[model samples]
Target: MKVMKVAIIDYNMGNLHSVGRAVKHVAPGGTQVEITADPDFIRHADRIVFPGQGAARDCMRELETRGLSEIVREVAKTKPFLGICMGMQVLMEFSEENAGVECMGVYAGKVNYFKHLNIAHLKTPQMGWNQIQQKTAHPLWTGIKDAARFYFVHSYYVEPTDQSLVSGETFYGLNYASAIAKDNVFAIQAHPEKSAEDGLRLLANFMQWQP
Candidate 1:
């Protein structure tokens, strides 16, 4: 069998070390994880992971500056693309957090900050561990139990127009789209790298997921 080569997009926004380490640990031997800024590598990668660690506009700018916008879009179309943290948010058409910046538009929606009646008591960022209520079953959640707690560090959340695209959700003053997948594009608001065992399993599942 050919080894599954995973390309972790090194767009300067990803938590590179942690994500790279986690993929190395969970994936089978011969599965190589490469951190690359090269568009060609990303375009040809068997699996692509778009991990983000900072602001939405900054990340979008970086992709545009590096001329990776269209390349990333092409990769997402054919290969299994996984987005984490701000990476996940960038999959949408726009982000309310950034005001006017456009995103990859893989998913139809806008990412917005938390706002609800019960939100006054809770924190803004919603940092630390939270239970991800699995909404729709996907290959990425195989062998993973329901209500799995994943590490999250974000203030904004995705409000997808297509409800069917949502794969999982979490409550932080309000229920938000924590995970979503439509065809080859898969994304998560939670950080699987910091999520321990279940996170590892999620990464493993992504490695084996065939688009």
Candidate 2:
């Protein structure tokens, strides 16, 4: 069997290893899960996974400092790229998480913090499993059942100016976009690798996606 290389950008954030492990399990053996900063590695890979944690501003700074911002932009514009968690948020133009910071600008929007709503009575940092409401069908959600529960752990979320890009949504203190896709870039605010069967199916679907 042939192996397709999948590169997971390792800019010192999030559970990169877990994402790589999950990809490897679904990929044919000998397929790589490279944790690298080399532009060549990213350029040559069949797919890229940007699994992110921590603050959006911090992730942006690291991408800039490592000169990865330019490479990532080029890669995202042309290849199959997936963003997880904060990885998804930073793909937008800005984030409010740190008094506002400019992001990759792959999508036109700003990241906003979750606010308390009188009706929900939920706390911020809406952690734990939440049901993802599928708004549209795409190859990424091919094997994912509608209203599948996925893991989430964040206080802020992205609000895309392009509603057509939103693939799924979920509720916390309020309803917000849980996943987004634009051209070659695909992202999900939830961690599919941690969501068990449904999440794993989502990951598998992504691995099998073609441009």
Candidate 3:
């Protein structure tokens, strides 16, 4: 049998060690997990895990600087691709960040910032644990409860043109599409590496996921 190979795309940004460790911990014994920016290896891998953080414009710049933007869009279409945090946000066509920035365009959407909230307590960069209300059934949601909380640290969230693509939603100041799924692509705005039990389960499910 062919051993499963997972590529954690490296663009010289985000928490690579934590994301890599989390995936390795949950993946089956023989599965291979490689952290790479190389296009050839990435395209050949059976699965792809994209984890990112920091500013939206910077993220796109790095992906482009490393010549990985198009490669990511190409492989995502044919393989089981999982995106996390800023990784999820950049899948959109454009973003209302740093004036404006074009993205990978894997999905028809825009990444919007969390505007100022009326509540004195609520704020942008919705850091900490928040519940993810599953909007659609999916393999990534396996073993995780409907309202399970996941770790998140971001000021922007994605808005897909197609509501049917949303697999999960969360409310900071208002409800937003916190997760999306379609064909071989699945993305979440939460940080599964930092999340505890339920988060690990989600990673494990990704390991066995066929889609």
Give me the candidate number with maximum lDDT: 3
What's the ranking of the predictions by lDDT, best on top? 3, 1, 2
User: Would you list the rank order by TM-score, best first?
Assistant: 3, 1, 2
lDDT of 3 at 1: 85
**Cα TM-score per model:** 0.95, 0.94, 0.97
Model 3 misplacement above 4 A: 116-120
lDDT of 1 at 128: 94
Q: Tens digits of per-residue lDDT for model 1 on 1-211?
A: 9767889988788689999999989888888689998887787779998899888899999999989888888888899899899888988899876666788898789888774335557788889999999998899999899998999998888989999999999998888899998898889999999998899999989988887
Query: Which residue ranges in model 2 land beyond 4 Å of their true spot?
Result: 116-120
Candidate 1's C-alpha runs over 4 A off are 115-118
- Give candidate 2's TM-score: 0.94
Residues 1-211, candidate 3, lDDT per residue (tens digit)?
Answer: 8999999999977999999999999999899999999899999999999999988889998998999998899988999999999999999999999989988888899998777345566677788999999999999899899999999999888899999999999998889999999999999999999999999999999888997
TM-score of 3: 0.97
Q: Candidate 2 clashing pairs?
A: none
Best by TM-score: 3
Backbone clashes under 3 angstroms, per model: 0, 0, 0
